[model samples]
Target: MAKLPEGILGPVSGTIGSIVGAKWRGVYYIRSKGKKRKKTRSKKQLASQAKFKFLQEFLKPFRPYFIVGFQNEALYCSEWNSAFSANYKAVTGQSPDFAIDYTLVKLSSGLQPGLRDPNVRYAARNKVEMTWTFQDEPMVTYDDQITMVIYCAEMNKAQGSIGGVSRADGKFVFKLNPRIAGKELDIFIYVSSLNRKLISPTHYLGKLIYASTTKP
Candidate 1:
């Protein structure tokens, strides 16, 4: 039995043939009332699930950066989802083993000009310093905020800054966590507008061992 609250042409509620009609979260939906059969997942399906799960865990630490880095691409989806969808193929491996290729990872995307002659080095006292030259492109401003992301898989940690530096500054420095010391870390950097409407593609600063000897 189905009832059309708004009339015969409107949405119906209750069972209609093999489906049941209902409203949930203010949205009307129809679904089959028949019991669903249990089906074993294929190898490909299982592999895909593993790949997605792996990527999700790997990307979890970068959520803060993704909020602004992937904002432009988040018109329909969340910033995190936008980042995942954009880099899924580039970061994941093929077929059975979906190993992540960190070098191929991209953290942000936009037409904003990216860093030129970017460089990173370990300074005294466990501090990491990054420097770059800004490209002379239209709409590129000196106030564009700089964002850095660092990941150390061996220590299962990620750290970075989202803003506070600008393109005109050309350099930024931050101290590393002692826990991740002496570990090989992957570093990435990009620039985004103050309002976060624009962003530059992420630049991989390559892997570097944080062999800092100083304590504190």
Candidate 2:
């Protein structure tokens, strides 16, 4: 075929086709966009990505805790691990590379021992004491530190977190201020381990209003 004159070619100067100039074998040539790659995805893949996106929204506030849990390798062989493996394979056509992807980390981090919420009790002196025990796997790890936080809903202010108790016992007592003693207080508890490299995840126990003891 005789070489076309150098310049824009027919029907090749827009989104579909742009007959720009090119040199080939000491000759100028016009070219158009090549066939698209034809990207495709399976229903499972779409489902997997959709699940991931949803999980990102659900776990945004808890990211710090989730990363820590993921780093500690806590999700092994759990329901989450199995579910993730299935869903991710459906999307990626293979097992996870486990390269610490952010979404994966967050999802895995949020999953821990779903221990029943600890029983919170009003103690002897405007203090809150929490008691809980794991039936199967222990929720409290050796290096874990338990912390309790209190907030007054009516005041819309956090009394703040206190009581860095050891996880070995799975129980902690935190005192409330006199000013907010009779007021209802929301309570939250989370566990943190000694590892500084990973971000910690918080597992809230429950909430309660603080009051002085009715008895010893």
Candidate 3:
């Protein structure tokens, strides 16, 4: 029960006599030597970092689910890489590391489904019509679910249509505020399989200037 210097008011019971314990800010704290981070990374750590960075952007459309407090970058990367390796081995019968980049693209890309040319137009009061036909998936199953990521250039933010392809005719309609007319709007299309077991690479549809105005 001896008091120590620098506000450390408790006895350290551990074998390491070099360290000291203290109670600060209503919490018990311990002081220890600090270690520096390694500049070089192992292959597995590098791979984990790569997948983590890709997932940050790839899962942007579904931020809350993949990036919740329950998960961390390092662990998440490891989990995703492990999952990818297992799936790749099952599908192509090859070492997963050999095609990590290719696999990353396949998993992150939103338009990999190879949808035909997309058409976008201003429809009536404050709605826009988007239509596109699908192309057959050559090596694997085709993706049927669609997501339209709308990048409002002026706002520097994005809004996505979760069920952009729920319509029966492969058409998507969304209402926009006329106040945003004349501003630039960028669109991206992403498709996933019905079961969502697969997601395609993203396809960039040219920028569309909102034309409808409430005043006119």
After best superposition, candidate 1 residue 60: deviation in angstroms?
0.6
| Candidate 3 per-residue lDDT over residues 20-40, each given as its tens digit | 556543555567645578689
Give TM-scores for every candidate, taking all chains together and pairing residue i with residue i. Answer: 0.78, 0.41, 0.47
- Of the candidates shown, which would achieve the greatest TM-score relative to the real structure? 1
Pairs that collide in candidate 1 are none
Model 2, residue pairs in steric clash? 12-17, 12-18, 12-19, 45-91, 65-200, 65-201, 66-109, 187-207
Please list the C-alpha lDDT of all candidates, in the order they appear.
0.81, 0.48, 0.50
Write candidate 1's Cα lDDT for 1-216 as tens digits. 988999988887999889899886467778889877599989888888888887887888888887778878876557888888877876556655566677667788898887789998776446778988877778789899999988888765789999899988988987788877556788999888888878898888888765556434
Residues 1-216 of candidate 2 have per-residue lDDT tens digits of 233443445222234234455554354445664766667978778766666764434334333333334444543343444334433422322223222222222222333333345777777557777777643454435545554556564554445442256555666767777766667765655555545332234444445644454453
As for lDDT, the candidate ahead, 2 or 3, is 3
Per-prediction RMSD in angstroms? 4.5, 15.4, 12.8
Angstrom error at residue 153, model 1: 1.2
lDDT of 2 at 194: 46
